[model samples]
Target: MTIVETTSEVEAVVRDTLAVHQSFFLATSGSAGPWVNGAYFAETGLFTLSLVLEQRGRSLAAIRDNPVVSVIISTGSPTEPFLQAQATARIVEDAEADEVRRVLLAKVPQVEPFLGTPVAAVELRVLSWRATDIPNGWLPGRDLYDTSIPVAREHRG
Candidate 1:
């Protein structure tokens, strides 16, 4: 495995990880307290991911109440790197649903079966990311990247 030490290198690792992972854990909070759900995700842009959610589901309801969320994606291996991030999520508006669907389908075709169902696409813009540096012998250590500050990257995937 390649050792990642710079921001650009870490970005590449993140992109690669997102490209390969099919699902992630999404955590949200609401009047009912906190909740977490597994969902398929597609990398939609720099520090961004998109997933489908039931319009009236707990996760969506939580997101409606609080846009802030935590996400975790792993390779499912103890020695492999994993990713955790803090993000702001929102249900895709009707105006952009089509485009978001297109992007989601391009990455996760298995989701096509549910596209006709009453599902809404939710967009997650990561505020900050913590990526494990396992490849560099940092077993539990993670390198942090903040996206709150503008970076030179395209907004659209």
Candidate 2:
């Protein structure tokens, strides 16, 4: 059976995974084969994403070779590290780039500085997701799916 999750199920997992981590490994390919780069990603919405690019060399090169990409953002909790949420990447075109930027900048700081560089803006349309056990198998896909992510109480910022 093809287990494509419902939009809510997908959104729940994406939101939870996004909240747990600030960055993800973006995988891409070139004439060599495959490559992965890391960056802090902003989940603007269900079908939108934007990540900080310190430099766009490798990533932009890969995108130029091929537009397909995959991003894996995992909860690094040693207790359960394999429970990762993934997003399929689609390089956003110039026309829609500003819209995605606006959504991401709302939650992120110092975005304008990064835009000064020749950076890349990637859009991710979440296809499927699987959340791990949460103190009784009540992962986000279960009845406890909650999208509310309040600012972390211990956030020093």
Candidate 3:
């Protein structure tokens, strides 16, 4: 398989991945340290994910202390050992409490009636993205695998 080399191509694949994978790993770090966490996410836009995070949880607290965070979401296909990545995370949130909550709740219907929920709202803005293909053993190429070629096979007598 050929790796994408253009920004538009990257964006399209990332957008597709974001649509396919609703849950992504959210990693956060504080002034003192860094920690990784997982959660179910909803996309607010092509490159935006809005989720209601526990206000006091390590992930939320860390982001509060240090807004920088990392998120990874792979194509759900069974690519194993070579699944393609969508994008990198740079967590951004709404300053207006209600707005943040609104965006988060909009994506998650179950959050509709949780008015008193103590979770902070956030939108992870993807900063940079990377894409790679699985290594199919045979022909040599960039990695240990060879690139897949396009062709049409015909069956004839």
Runs with alpha carbons beyond 4 Å of true place in candidate 1: 1-5, 144-157
lDDT by residue (tens digit), candidate 3, 2-21: 44444455455556666666
Lowest lDDT sum, 10 consecutive residues, model 1, at 148-157
Candidates in order, TM-scores: namely 0.85, 0.63, 0.60
Q: Report lDDT (CA) for all predictions.
A: 0.79, 0.57, 0.54
In candidate 1, the residue pairs with backbone N, CA or C atoms under 3 Å apart (3 or more residues apart, or in different chains) clash, namely none
User: Relative to the unseen true structure, what is the C-alpha lDDT of residue 115 in candidate 3, on a scale of 0 to 100?
Assistant: 42
Please write out the lDDT profile of model 1 over residues 93-134, one tens digit for every residue.
786788778888888899898888988888998866667767
Enumerate clash totals for all models, in the order shown.
0, 0, 1
**Top model by lDDT, which number?**
1
Worst 10 residues of 3 by lDDT: 148-157
lDDT of 2: 0.57
Alpha carbon RMSD to native, model 2: 10.1
Best by TM-score: 1
Error of 2 at 124 (Å): 1.8
